[model samples]
Each structure stands twice: as C-alpha cells, then as structure tokens.
Target: MVASVFSIYVRTVHRIWRQVKNSGMHVDVSHKRTGNCGRKRIQIDLTQFLEIPLRQWTTLDSLACSINMNKTTLFRRLKSGAIRRHSNAIKPILKEENKRSRFQFCISMLDESSIPQDPIFKGMYNIVHIDEKWFYMTKKI
Candidate 1:
C-alpha cells in the first residue's frame, strides 16, 4: 500500500521501514553516492593539444593519432565539454599587388555616371564564367 501510494518499489519501502524501525526516532534516508562516484573522466591536456599544428587538428582521427589517444575517447571529451572543436576555413593569403588588382577590378565594375550620385556595379551581361576543368575535359586535344 505504501509502495503503491508513493510510487516506489516495494523493496525500497521495506528498506526504508527497516531503517526507521532500527533508528526509532530518526531515520537518515538520503542518497549515499557522492559527486566523486563513478568512473574517473579522462583528462585532456590543453597545452599539449594547442601545441599540435592546425592541420593535425582537422580530424578527430588525425588528432587522436598525433596525441596517442583513442578517437572515441577524444570524441567523448568533445561531447562532454572537456575539449572544443573548431571549424576554421582556409583563407587565401593575398599580397599587396593582389589586393590592389582586386580593388582595381571592383573600381572598373562601378558605373561611371553613378559616381557623382549613388555608385553601383554595371549589369555585367558581357561576362561569361566557364569552369576551366570542365572546358578542358570536353576538348579533344
């Protein structure tokens, strides 16, 4: 009756009853497990991780190989907030000459008449973009 009313297992109710009967006035029924209980979490050294090059950090498998750690363990660390995964896109390193050329190209695209008022690019109907790879593949030579 007590187990059904409390929505707890009969065995649990029996254990509590035993405790209360033994203690008479006071019954200490609290959780026994502490925060430190359970399997110890694997620790990751941030300094060592940071020392590895960006290229090695590209994939979890590569990183695991470099650090001598299991890929699954590394993945678990990532999921548990012990480590962070960053997706950094590779950007082209443009020189000053390249920058100047890009700027000149943008300047040429602007309408000359609109320079005095609101400057905007031309309709660009003359430009045709063709993939060099596709063009070369279709050619006989």
Candidate 2:
C-alpha cells in the first residue's frame, strides 16, 4: 500500500513539473477573445436627452430610449439651456387679518428683554391652540 502511494505521489510531481515547463498551458485560457477589438456603437443627440430632464423632471437614460437620442448629446443641449427649468408649483396665499398684532402678543410673553436670544421651533409649534390654564405674561397698555 505504501509503495502504491509513493508511485502516485511521484506521478503527481512529475505531471506538475511537465506542466510548469509548458508555459502556454498556464496562459489565461478564459482570455480567448483578448485580441478582439470591435467597433463601438455611437451615441447621438445629447442635447435632447439633457433638456428632457430639466423640462419634464425625467432622467436622460429614460428620455434617450423614448426619443431614440444619445444621452451625451442631450446633456450638451441642457448645458446650453435649450431645455429650461420647469414652472414652479408653489403660489403664495394672501390672507386679510391683523397678523402683526398676534405675533406681538406672543413675543411679549417670551420676554424678549430678559431673553435676548430666541429659540427655533420645530414643525407646527407656532400654530398651537393652548387652554386657559397655560397663562402668558402681558403688561398693561
């Protein structure tokens, strides 16, 4: 049994030495297409692709597929301002009321004289409706 194992070990070492001598056998077999140099597909119409996003809030990749334009060209168009910024959605509301007086009342309670610095309130803290139990200090006019 030992003799057989020694024979196998000798055969394995011999095979390894033979393979090492043959350098081509160790070369990257997976890189069969290493020498291959193919023509690249050109991207077209970068301007159109770029403008679509700013005008419509969509991505260049998506817009390119839809209009059959190159993303690069679309970017150029956007840079030149061919595609403009979209119109704003927000509009200010004009309400008729004595807003200044209400603000003054709240400020007086905080005692701006004693407290030089004001704290920043979070979320809807300004529009609170407190009960009569929570009293605010106010001086006579």
Candidate 3:
C-alpha cells in the first residue's frame, strides 16, 4: 500500500540524513526546485503576485520569485509597506464566531524537547559570540 511505501521512504530519508550527519558531511544545496514558468518575462508586480494568488502563497521564496525580486528586496518592500495585502485576504471563520465569540481560544506552544535533537553540532553551539560591539553588526553586514 501507499502507507508502507511512504514509511519506507521516510525511513530511508531519515537514515540518510543521520548517516550524513554522523559522517560530518555538509551538503551544500544550491539549486532551487521550481521557477515562475515564463512569468518573469511580463515583470509581474508585487500586488499582482499577492492579489492573483489571493494570499495562498505565504512563503517568502515563492513571493520573491513570482514578483522577480530577491528575498531581501521583498522583505524591504514589506517592511516599508510599499506592497499591500488585499482586503480580507484571510477570510474569517464565520459571522457567528465574529459576532458572538466571547473569549479567544487559549493556545499553548510546546516545542519538541521530546523529539531527539540532532546529534551533530551538539556541543559546538553552547559558545556565545563574546564581542561587546555585536549590536552594531546585527542589521549590518
């Protein structure tokens, strides 16, 4: 069945990832998987990318490629509010939920301390950068 194949594939990927880590091999993944498919010729603006997709594509990589801009440029536009999101880009759940919702849902985030951490780079991360002038270098190169 499909489930068994998926399980085997997941196991294979995990085993490979583990082996690569254990062997201290750093894989430099450079190329991306997808492109805008000739949309780059039209020079689609940021608004067109956001509006036509109707806010479905939330990732920065996709938005950047679709609008033919790099991630840094897209982030700069977003921070400067040059690009605006369409109205009701995210449609609400319901009118009743909007009208009569007395209390907001209380949510809790529990990160995976339970899941096994990566074995490689275990002890190397504990050392902090001990420069006093590290602040001026935060947003700069």
Candidate 4:
C-alpha cells in the first residue's frame, strides 16, 4: 500500500519498514559511509622538498621534474594539503637616500609645539591614499 501510494519500489518500502520495526518508533536512516573507506594517501618527505631552491618552486612541472615526481601527483598532493605553495614578493631594496627621505617625511609629521613636551604626530586629516598601479589618466589612442 505504501509502495503504491508513495510511487516507490516495494523493496525500498520493505527495507524502511523493517528498519523502523527493528529500531522501535525511531529509525536510524543516517549514511553509513566513513572517511577510512578510501585509498591511503601517498606520503611525501617535506624536508627533501624544502631543500630544493625557491626559484625551482615557481612552476609545478619544473618542481616535479627536479624531485623526479609526476606533475599530476604533485598537484594532487598540493590540493590534498600534503604540500604547500609559497609565494614571496620581490621588494625593491631601499638605498641610503631613500631611507633618509623616509626619515624626513616621518619627522615632518611630528607636531612642532608638542615636540618640546610630549612628541606627538599632527592629526593627518589631509592625507589621501591613492593606488597608482590601477589609476590610469589616459585612454589608449
């Protein structure tokens, strides 16, 4: 009657009814799949990987070639959290003149009157920060 009414297979209805009967009023219909059912994850030596120079770590193909491992496997390891990717930005080295200019700019911010008593910076209400990288002034002709 339940199979005909719900438009489901008789076997499925029987299985559900059997579960409810066995467990009393409440039925445990939760999924039985566990995390341990999958194939074991391949182990990687992180120390050996780190020993390779930072320059070689730029591309997965090059890094995998240097370590004698398949690129696909390396990528899988990266996705699985077994391996990490580090990106270090190359900062411009500041010269003595640049350092001096920065120091002078910092000094200029100090309140002249407060310097003698409690050295404090002036309330910088006029300062406006602009990212020049994406700020374009002209349209391409």
Candidate 5:
C-alpha cells in the first residue's frame, strides 16, 4: 500500500512537472486560471449611469432594463460593490419663527432636573406626533 501511494505521488509530481514545462508556467504559481475561471463581469460606466435621470432608474429592474442588462447581473454588481444604492432625503427648511417654536417645544419637553449647562430630555413620549414637510418652489419631476 505504501509503495502504491508513493508511486501515485510520483506520477502526480511528474505529470505536474511535464505540464509546467510544456505550458511554460511557473511550478510555484497559483491562480493560473483565475482570470479565465469565472464568467466575465459586466462593466457599467459611471458617467452614463449618472447621465440617466433618477426617474429612469427608479428601481433595480428599471435600471437594468434601461442599461440592457439582466436584473440579476445588476443586483450582482450591487452585491459586489460595483454599484451602490442611495436613499435621497430632503431636510425640512424651517423659517425663523418655526425654528424658535421648535426650540421652545424642545425646552418644554426637557426633564425638570436637567439644567442650562447640560440639558436632558424627559424622554420622547410626548413628542411622537411631530411631522414636518418641505415643499419645493418649483415643480420637481
């Protein structure tokens, strides 16, 4: 059994040596076929993507169809860090009076023990119903 194992090992080493010599590949090399092993990745140009309006690329499926790629491929790009997802949020623009009112409301909600130097909240139970909205001056698509 030992002799057979030795012979098998010798045969594998000889075969590898022969292949290395014929293929002109380094004996100690690794990942020799790594570049050719996997399916080619899709390349998306950032400039082209940026040029497309947000409405056109509203969803992953829409964006993939617009760019002429499979949704799975596009999703793979997102997973592989080739693409990223962003949620755009607009902050409410408060006027001077609105700001003062908000400041006063916050002050009223403060814990009694809290002082001017270090203000603390009495917890947010009373302030849960607050909602603010911002409207653009011009129509937005």
Candidate 6:
C-alpha cells in the first residue's frame, strides 16, 4: 500500500526497510537520499586565483590554463557566479588650471541673456552637470 501510494516498487521499499531494520535506525524523514549524497563540488582557492597575473586573467582559456584548471569548468564557475570579472579603468588627472579653465568655459556657456553682447548668444541653461565635483574623465581598459 505504501509502495503503491509513493509509486515506488514494493521490492525496493522492502529492501530499504530491511536495510534500516538491520542498521537499527528508524527513518525520521521521508527523503530517500542522505544529505551531501551527490558528487562533491570542487573547492577553489580564491587567493591563488587572485594572485594570478592580470595578463593571464584577461581570457577564460588563458586563465584556466594558468590556474591549472579545465576551461569548461572555469567557464562553468564563472557562469554559476562562483567567479567574478573586473573591468579596469583609468581616471584622467586634471590640474588646478585646467579645472579653472573648465569652470570658466561652463560659465561662458550660460544663457546669452546674462552675457552682454551685440549678437545675442544662446545660454545653455538647459544643460545640467551630473557631477559638480571630481570631474576627472575615465577611460576604460
């Protein structure tokens, strides 16, 4: 009846029951498989991975080869969120004079109505600067 309800073969259920009886352990839970039953996951040491040169980590194949790991496994690890990718960017440094020139240019661009001129110049009052401070430009590598 238990086998019919669970849709398992009676012989299979009886075999499991006999094994449990012999082991002198009662089934406390309905789960057939024990915890940690499947194939164990590979444990990767991240410090070793981080210590690898930047040049080697640029490509998956190169990274895998450098780390002495399989390319597919490494790709899988990346896809599964086990690994992370970083993008390198460099910020352009501007001198104090350059910043002052930029500020002057920005002020000059203000609505022509404010600037007294023979020909009316259109002030770009509509333009909004997202970052008022630390205006260094960034270049992505």
TM-score of each: 0.42, 0.24, 0.28, 0.38, 0.45, 0.43
- Per-residue lDDT for 56-136 in model 2, tens only? 334556565566767676677667676643433222232445467667666656634556576533345467686753242
Candidate 2, superposed: residue stretches over 4 Å from native: 1-61, 88-119, 123-141
Candidates ranked by lDDT: 1, 4, 6, 5, 2, 3
Candidate 6 lDDT, tens digit per residue, 1-141?
999998998997888888788777875536668765998777778888878877666567878888888888888888899997665433336779979999888667556665666535465577676864444432122
Which pairs clash in the backbone of model 4? Answer: none
Worst 10-residue lDDT window for candidate 1 reads: 132-141
Better candidate by lDDT, 1 or 4: 1
Leading candidate by TM-score: 5
After the best TM-score superposition of candidate 5, give how far the Cα of residue 74 lies from its true spot, in angstroms. 0.5
Overall local distance difference test of candidate 2:
0.52
Note the clash tally of each candidate.
0, 10, 0, 0, 0, 3
By the lDDT metric, which is better: model 3 or model 4? 4
Better of 2 and 4 by lDDT: 4
User: Of models 1 and 3, which has the larger lDDT?
Assistant: 1
Record all residue pairs in model 5 with backbone atoms less than 3 Å apart, i.e. clashing.
Answer: none
Report RMSD for candidate 2.
18.5
How do the residues 40-127 of candidate 1 rate in per-residue lDDT, one tens digit apiece? 8778888888788766776788889888899999999888888876644333467799899999999999999999999999999999
Q: Give the CA lDDT, 0 to 100, for residue 98 in model 2.
A: 45
For candidate 2, list the clashing residue pairs, or say none.
44-70, 46-72, 46-73, 46-74, 46-75, 47-73, 47-74, 47-77, 49-74, 50-74
Q: List the residue pairs that clash in candidate 6.
A: 110-123, 111-123, 112-123
